[model samples]
Target: MSSTKKVKDSHTIMTQLIMPNDTNHLGNLMGGVMMRWMDIVCALSAMRHCNTPVVTAAVDHISFQQPIDLGSMITLEGFVTRTFRTSLEVFVEVYSEDLKGTKTKCNDAFFTFVSLDEDTKRPSKAPGIIPESKREKELFEGALRRRDLRLIMAGRMDPKSADHLKKIFS
Candidate 1:
């Protein structure tokens, strides 16, 4: 695998219309429905980045900032922020657009995925992210801390061993 891949190399965008079936009785898009889309887009981005079968390891953070009503167009965008030994982090953002082209950010999330070897069903290395924009660079730097926090919360890493997160509190 190459040492690094540009952010655009694995970026993914999906658009869908919020229909009756995707909304609740209140006529707003359901949280689960939005999450499902987020996971799908994030997984696609991860697969694009790794060029292998990837599975969702964890959804680090997902925030529904605003409610999207039925009849709105929903856009989900995802890009690789950083990569670890066998896993990579993708930052996903969801926006809702009205008929007039007015856009509102509805959700934001970070997802982690691990690449798998098709023959062995084992974890495979992921390519590193080479940030192209300032925003991508910032996200790339923060991804390490986010990964440490996720590992600590999942009991896969010790709090004391999390250098990036430790600095946050200190």
Candidate 2:
């Protein structure tokens, strides 16, 4: 919860070329397709951080604030927010860029990934924090917030909704 404990320097930036096949009847990239790309971008960051294969544990939240048209350039940025014994929380931002170099934020989401020991096919510990900059700290702190939000959304903090929460959260 403290700012000093957060790490913020780590980041991953990627650009994707949208194709006709990724579009819907409306000529815009499908939301599902974008989400899949987001997952890949986030996973790449997690793997680079841990130096191991990672599997998606959960996606905390996804908001499609803007539509991305086919043939537009898609930019994705991802970074580590936090790490547990075997899991890492990553935040991803999606943007659509135009030929004139202007960019629009399309979506932002938090995803949790668990590092896996490929040989054992089981959860494994991630690398230790070596944050060297203020950005890393901010990212770590943000990840903490995302984790809390996920718990709250799952109804873990609501007593009255406990039953409904368990069925879904579990």
Candidate 3:
């Protein structure tokens, strides 16, 4: 991997058509189905950054803003927000499109994945990411706080020790 790479270097996009199997009785896409799509797109972004296979470590703050109707077109875009030693966080935004081609943001989430070594099957170093655009910079900065929150929620980190989070509430 290079010393660092741009956010666009790991950008990933996916589109899916909502079908009966992917929907609930209400004809809206099932939350689990949406989550599965999010995971796939995010993993792609992570793998692009690391140049190695990656596994989902955690997913946080999944917001379902709108329901995707049956037969509607849905697009999910994911990019690496930041990369650490052997893991990275991806921001995925899901949009629902109508027949008229109008799109509405339906869901969004942050996913963390660990890069893996093919031979040893252990965590491996991941390339760092550089934010170029304003939105990318913002997400890159906030990634640390979001990662801290995930760790706290998972009982892997103490809330008091989250310096990035402290700055927000303080």
Candidate 2 residue pairs in backbone clash: 6-137, 7-136, 7-137, 8-135, 8-136, 8-137, 9-135, 9-136
Clashes of each: 0, 8, 0
Candidate 3 lDDT tens digits, 1-170: 53789999889999999999999999999999999999999998888888888999998877778888999999999999998788899999999999999999987889999999988879988888889999999998998888888999999999989999888988
In candidate 2, stretches whose alpha carbon ends up further than 4 angstroms from where it belongs are 1-10, 132-135, 151-170
Give candidate 2's error at residue 129 in angstroms. Answer: 2.1
lDDT for each residue of candidate 1 in 5-27, tens digit (9 for 90 to 100): 88898889999999999998899
Clash count (model 2, backbone only): 8
Worst 10 residues of 3 by lDDT: 59-68
Quantify all predictions' global Cα lDDT against the true fold.
Answer: 0.90, 0.77, 0.90
TM-score of each: 0.96, 0.79, 0.96
Error of 3 at 39 (Å): 0.4
User: What lDDT is reached at residue 49 by model 3?
Assistant: 86
